[model samples]
Target: MSALFPALLTASNKQALRFDGRALTYAELAATAGSLAERIEGAGRVAVWATPTLETAVGVVAALLAGVPAVPLNPRTGERELAHILKDSTPTAILAAPTDQLPPALAELTRIEVVVAGAADPTPERTLPQTDPESPALIVYTSGTTGPPKGAVLPRRAIATTLDALADVWGWTADDVLVHALPLFHVHGLILGILGPLRRGGTVRHLGKFSVDGVTRELSSGATMLFGVPTMYHRIAESLDTDRELTKALAGARLLVSGSAALPVHDHRRITAATGRAVIERYGMTETLMNTSVRVDGDPRPGTVGVPLPGVELRLADDSDGIGEIQVRGPNLFSGYLNRPDATAAAFTEDGWFRTGDMASLDADGYVRIVGRKATDLIKSGGYKIGAGEIENALLDHPGVREAAVTGEPDADLGERVVAWVVPTDRQSPPSEEELANHVAAQLAPHKRPRTVHYLDTLPRNDMGKIMKRALKSA
Candidate 1:
């Protein structure tokens, strides 16, 4: 019932957003976004060219101010995927930056170019227009593995509830400044990275693109938090040993969070070993903005994505040995897939819980350790439900192993035998199958160890750094 961001109407003119080199204060952002909202205030759904720039943020905020649902289109979206999204959402207008070279699919729609010029102005409403909390705020499309991408319609209440809940859990406040270089099309980067700071009345400094030097520069200056995927954090781990400034910068940060994919325990340990600060981990998807996170004051467990947020109710479905598909019910959950009532109905249970499709287990203390995806990462071998994530983590701990992913292959006796795809630390001398097998066996159970080993220079990964295990079945 409260305003999403009260600061837009009441806060002092302090810096709100800084992307690359450009900065905009709170008053400047309100004036710029407010002026734009007046033009398209009554439009149907609008599509935003979600590049990691100031324009994307402004367009989204303007859509919020205008009480319109904004669909964020990935700038690097392929022709097929772009076509699919455009066809599905049917946005009335496409919002982009002046310099954007848009694809042909968006050419037909009414284009709104977001331009924020000059410093903070003394023009802002004492009271902003009210929008229904149940109204759709954004329609974020999922990366369709089964078929064309399905749009997840997120409500205004979902965003507000999730951010406010995160604030309670993370001790977030107005003084905290966030620094990240995540993309704007996805929930983790856009909703949580950009919107979270704004909702908290804090500042966000985006790196445009992630760089070791850029991260260090921002954190060293005044930033208090860092949000990154495993790939970026892996690079940070690889560099922390020699890069004194990077290590120092990380150690000074109040919080470091990783999400969008499982951050291997090796990377987690490496970063902590270097900086004396544990990187907090959270779990979410396109359908759910955020469900759980490691509390800032709680123990920063290496492999765990901490307890459920304030109002989120989480329970495992069809559990055998603690691991099961995670189903959740919360205000933070999306309303449904846009224009797909059948698909939407299928995503939730008859009891109204959203099926997360990810397999995980809760620890004694309620910490969630996400094993992997149910379809690809849950390996059934030798009558054991072995999570591929644990085996992969064990394989990564090997001295000769640079990267690893585990899978289950069809077998006559075991139903499905465990297979390990490993990237060697050195290409010239890959670890033997037997040696690596024994290494995993020692770390985990014998049935959990890899029955066969395949060597590769790299693992196939998506934009979020999550290993595409489905691709490996063909190999």
Candidate 2:
């Protein structure tokens, strides 16, 4: 109904974005985006060169200003993945900075170079075009775990609702400065990390690349908030005991949030012990921007992602043990997959709840603890629906274990048996299979213990520090 980022028109600040040592104020950004939006105002969906750069932000803003839904193309995307996205979205224009060279996959599209701010706003009276809130804003693709990744059409309403809900939960305000170094292609970086702050009329300092020094510098200097994936936080937790600057910087921050993947309880405890600040975890997916999060004022539960957001209604479908596939209904839900009507229809239930394909359980207080994904993380063994995440966490609790992933394998007798893939802290003095099995058996049920154990030097992880469980099974 109204403009998504009203701050761009009202705010006069000159520090809206601090990207790669370059800063653009709200006035400069609005001018740059408005100029670009005028050129492609009537185009179909556009494809973005989603690099972690100031120009990338400008490109996305321009698309939004023009009411053109953009498909963000990851710079590191493989040829196959790139091909699928290009064929599916079929954008009319490709947006990129002068420095970015187009890949072979984008050879078929019409390319347009993204220009940085030119001079200043000549006419501030011409505001962003008011578009329908239900119109598609983005066509974000999934991780392609099942098949060729489907384009989830995110509407303007979803973005506005999710950001407003987060603002209320985290006590976020224009005075707060957010700092992060996450990739720009995904929701975590593009929406929450960048747009979230801009919507609140706040400043964002994005390290072109993440470094402990950058985290220390930004958080210690003026940044009030930090958003990172589990991998970055793990490194921070590991070094806190040795790095005084980092510990102090983290301690002084107003808030620290982790998402994209679950943060291990061990890392959480270490960070809290070192800095006396708990890292808040939130749960969501490509289809749903955000559903649940540990509120800034709520108990800093080590392992659980706290209650559902304001408009989100969640239920565990047919699960009496407080655990099942998480089904949700909210304004934050995506419209549907771009052109795949059948697939999108199947994503929702008969009653219209979107089946989140994620297995989770709610505590007595309504905090959500995600067990794992429905496909890879749910291990049905001997009539028990075992969550691989619990066993993985228990294994992580062992001092000798470094990394662990659990999966189910075909077993004639039990239908499916639990298998453990472990990376020991010391290979030469690795923990015996018997000992590790007993360790899990003691923590959980003996039946849940690994029937077989495979040791590797390292676990296969994606860019976000998420264990690629599917890769492990094939490995």
Q: What Cα-based lDDT does every candidate model obtain?
A: 0.90, 0.89
- The number of clashing residue pairs in model 1 is 0
Clashes of each: 0, 0
**Structural RMSD, model 1:** 1.4
Q: After superposing candidate 2, which stretches have Cα over 4 Å from the reference?
A: none
Residue-level lDDT tens digits of model 1 in 1-475: 1277778876367899999999888888888888778777888889999999999999999899888899999888899999999999999999999999998888899988999766655755533357999999999998888899999999999999999988998899999999999999988888889999999999999999999999999999999999999999999999988999999999999999999988999999999999999999989887888999999999989989999999999999999988999999999999999999999999999999999999999998899999988988898877888888999899999989988999989999999999999999999999899999999889888888788899998999887788888888887
**What's the residue-level lDDT of 188 in candidate 2?**
91
The residue pairs that clash in candidate 1, if any, are: none
Error of 1 at 241 (Å): 1.1
For model 1, state the Cα shift of residue 166 in Å. Answer: 0.9
For model 2, state the Cα shift of residue 299 in Å.
1.0
